[model samples]
Target: MKKVALLVIVTFSVITTYGSIKSYNNLNISSGTMIAILIMIISLSIFLTLIIDRKTLKKRYIEKENELKHLNTELEETNIELESSYKKIEKLNSSILKILELSSFFSAPKLMERDFEKKVLDLALEIIEPAENGAIYLFDENNNAKMVFAKGYDYEKINELNLKKNDLIIPEKAEIIKDIHKINKNKMSPKKFAAFIKLGGNLKETLITPISFNNELFGIITLDIENNSPLKNYEDYHTKIMDYFGKTFAGFLKMLNFIKQEGKFHKDIALTLVKTLEYYDNYTRGHSERVANWASLIAEKMNLDKRKIEQIYWAGILHDIGKIFVPQSILNKAGKLSPEEFEKIKLHPTKGEELLKKVDGMEEISKIIRHHHERYDGKGYPDGLRGKNIPIESRILAVVDSFDAMISERPYKRSLTKDEAIYQLKRMTMKQFDGEVVRTFIDIIDNFNIK
Candidate 1:
């Protein structure tokens, strides 16, 4: 504005002087008109300059606004990326927690009440979303995949289509099918493909995962999703999770087998010890085996669980193991044991317990053996554990043991008739034996042949 104003003043001064000179010379134009024209030109020039400056300021402001908007867009995109990453992290954490829960569940012994394979499948279906149904195909003795457990599918139809190793298109770890109908014809055997399609007519997607450990395949797990499934996309994580579960189940089975073999090995050792005891005591040659059988039968009649019955059977076998420590002279004596000899005889239960407790997993059996002589009224043992204080297995052992002793011919006593033995058991019930156990035993043996 300053430069423009200065230039306008100089131009107007020159024009006014020229107009004055011309007017003086020829009297054609007046100096006053020239001055008025110069003023209008100056005013117009100032207005245009202001408009131009305003336009420049507006353009710069718009540029700055656009830069801010671009920055905000980038920040929003970054925030979205961060949010996605956080969600992924949360998902991973959830998966890890679920895996830990599975590890804990599979770690414990559920050998009695639960069908482990089916239970595992049920739990898997719960965590692995989009899976409407599943089946576990374990390899049978012939190395053929057999459907051991199934859910939400016709098990009989699937089982009829036995999946041989060569009939499968499953990857070593896992594979997913986007659409079951679109699966390549050559990927699986035609017979298997047709059977699968027939059995799973509504199935849209399938995830085939192998149960394996140390690269050795044990079985295959197949999970299905229907056409109307909630989640249509089978994510990478889903396959990973199923693969993890398959491997974990395989590991659990391996551990369970190891435990069973270990248990059998221990039982073998215990039976060997029983044989030694039987050899040392001729009067009780077949006593241990008979007691064990009768105890198991009584336990079964009482509806005890398989585990408890097995423990009772083993306890029966090992109950008299400590008699090996007793002097043969005292055992073969023709009369009743003297007080000192009786006291020594009473130590057998404790001695047997002490010996067996040293072995792993035999603590409960040792306890049963220790308290087998305990009376129902609390007056029949080294520990004198009374009634309910005694272990139920020990109480059962007492009934079977006393009845056998009454009927067996010993050095100083004649064998009682079956009727006499039943009377003795009845007379001793509630005093020396559990009334329920005694009743169960009598009922079982009434028609049972011991031979």
Candidate 2:
């Protein structure tokens, strides 16, 4: 509008100047009139230049505004991508932590075969989501499916179903069974398949995977979602995770079997030493076994872990192993031992430790054996370890070993009755034995006949 108005004013001024020049020529106009006309023209030219400059500045401002909007959009997109990446990193960290937790499960000590299988099933369930039920099945020599571990269902009922390897229509890889009844009856046993359908009303989706390594199937792990429709609840990664767990568990089982075989051999060697002690002194017959049984019972009553209880039991078996070095005359002596003979008896704990430390994996057992005679008040020999300084396994053994010896007949002394043995145990608390261990030992005596 300003440019158009300036153009109009300039046009009118030009026409007016033309008319004024004519008048000046005809009438001989004054010099002031010419100067006034020149001033008007100069003023219009200045106004037009200012308007053009303002238009250029306005255009630049609009361009700059558009550039800023584009930059803001790009920044917003980058923020979204960054937020997504951060979430992925957090999820990856969680998965890694779960994997580390699962990796450490097998290393835990003293789990029986069934306990180990149950642990595997539990850890698998933890990693996968929305799974309320799981079971682990092993293939027996007859190619029969034996339910070793079951969760979220009637365990006894499932085990009684008598599932066979040939009865299953599973592929080599892990799979999600969306509908159990949809499976072709011609490919699977109708009798067993119908049994699963009738066994649990809540069984909906089943993720069945083989526990295999090198294409050799050792077992099967099955996870279930209860009381839900057969929707696409699992992804490809779920099956992959199941497969990984199956293979890992298979490897663990193989290693466990090998370890069990090795453990049997080591046990046989330990038993041989026990038999040697028995042959040396007829009075000590069955003494070591009885002590082991009592120590294990006391350990169980104390709520010790499986690993520690096993160690205590082995320590009990080998507690008298060092006494093999003692002279037969000193062992069966009906009379009281001389001071020199007593010193020889005290050396047995140290001797037991020295002998067993040479064997692999017996390091912990040796430590327990070496300190079993150490009294709570430091009055006992072999280390004089006082108060809580003794290993817990040794403290447990101290109570059990003394009680068994008190109740068992020996050449040097008559066996005390059960009540008398219990009295002696209570009397010696905090002095000759750990009070907690003594109490734990006596509390469990009613479960077994001491003699």
**Local distance difference test values of all predictions, in order:** 0.80, 0.80
- Per-candidate TM equals 0.70, 0.74
Local accuracy of candidate 1 as per-residue lDDT tens digits, 1-451: 6556656776776677666666675655566876676677667667767776788789999999999999999999999999987876676667667867877776534643458778878877776667888888877667676777899878777778776765655578878876755553565678778777777667778888888888777788888888886556567777877777778888877777788888989989998997787677776678887889999999998899788898999999999998888888776678899999998889899999999999988998999999999999989888888889989999988988888888888778898888888888899888998899988988888765642
RMSD in order of candidates: 7.0, 5.4
Query: Distance from true position, residue 337, model 1, in Å?
Result: 2.6
Error of 1 at 409 (Å): 5.2
TM-score, candidate number 1: 0.70
lDDT of 2 by residue, 1-451 (tens): 6666777777788778867787768677767887787677867677776878689789988999899999999999999999977765665566557766666777736345447777777777877776778888888779888778788667678678887776654558889886555663454577766777676555667788888877778888888887564553765667767777777778777777777887888799999998888999776788788789989988888888888889889999999888888898898898889999989988889999999999877899999999999999999878789999999899988887888788887766899999999999999999898888888877788987655
- Model 2 TM-score on a 0 to 1 scale: 0.74
Candidate 1: worst 10 consecutive residues by lDDT?
105-114
